[model samples]
Target: MSPVSETHLAHRLNLRLNVEPSEIGGIRHTVIQHIGSWECAAIADDVILVVSELLANVHEHAEGVCELEIEHQDEGLVVKVSDTFMTPPTLGHRHGSAETGRGLLLVDALTDHWETTITGTGKVITCTFGTPGRGISP
Candidate 1:
């Protein structure tokens, strides 16, 4: 998939969040509210889960704060989380007993497409979820 340019997005929301576990619930609520307003219920759950997973990674691995950007595209919603951590995430094979390493796996399963881009400040993990049977407006 080609990178989504800002010009093509119908709607965009950007948020800066502290890397705290307590911040996850509030951010999830915010995302759901936006999804609700967008009338994209068909992919709401998937979008929420993907956002949660990405935020959890930021809280667990990154330092300071992270930026969350959600955009409405012609095909679906694009979610990007930027953090100060320079190392990109990898999908690691973990034992069933492992508790901490499965987030990215869940992210991979839920999103239609996902990629990590290293920036000068840090890295951004972008995820795309296709919305079906619904029309998204600006």
Candidate 2:
């Protein structure tokens, strides 16, 4: 018997979350479970942090509801959070006065690549993290 290859299969979880503050922890937990099911626990911790930040941003800044989609693809995990917000997230210059403005920065630092997609009804923010946790730094 041989061990399964890391990227042998694809797994996806699509979630529609009501942009409420209380359910964030639940969502995070579910995401962790899904990652575990896909046998990609190596990146589980990092994925949870990324999901938490993404959902928090949606609840705080975006309008209406949100959709979370996680997929295991091509030796990486694609985390996409969609919401009804027009403004794209930016990595602005944070001065001493800025109290809390580093969510995307953290996401970007922990993932292989990330980007934003604007749709007709809303926007989607997608972050891609390579398999087995590719060079992640806190």
Candidate 3:
């Protein structure tokens, strides 16, 4: 997928919000709206799905306040969820009739690249989804 174009991405990015389990739905809606407004509906579902999955991990495995930030950079839209969990999250596999353990898997597929980093206070999961932003890859 092409990037959204540097000009448009710069205009739509730099967003940061505090999020929790209770707030995921609303935040998801708002982010999707932003994506749609930018005429990036093609990747809207993928963006929301990845964000939800990341936040769900935060809710299940971490604690304290988590910050969700969406930014447009280089050739992709970057979504990050940071929380107070020093331990890095691990992707798991559960076969047959499993309801969980699929969030990270979904995230892995939707984003071109993703990784978790250890922050001073906790950890942050950052995933990059290729967007319509037309820019040099970074």
User: Each prediction's TM-score against the native?
Assistant: 0.85, 0.83, 0.78
| Structure candidate 3, residue pairs in collision | 3-132, 3-133, 3-134, 4-132, 4-133, 5-133, 5-134
Candidate 1 has its poorest 10 consecutive residues by lDDT at 1-10
lDDT of 3 by residue, 38-99 (tens): 66676789889998877677667775246667775546577777788899877888787996
Model 1 agreement with the true structure over 1-138: per-residue lDDT tens digits: 011222222377677777477757777777787887777778999889888888788877896368889987777898999999999999887899986889889888988888999999999998888787534332
Model 1 scores a TM of 0.85
Highest TM-score against the true fold, candidate = 1
Backbone clashes, candidate 3: 7
The models' CA-based lDDT, in order, is 0.79, 0.77, 0.70
In terms of lDDT, the best-performing candidate is: 1
User: Any idea how many clashes model 1 has?
Assistant: 0
Off by over 4 Å in 3: 1-20, 132-138
Pick by lDDT: 2 or 3, better one: 2
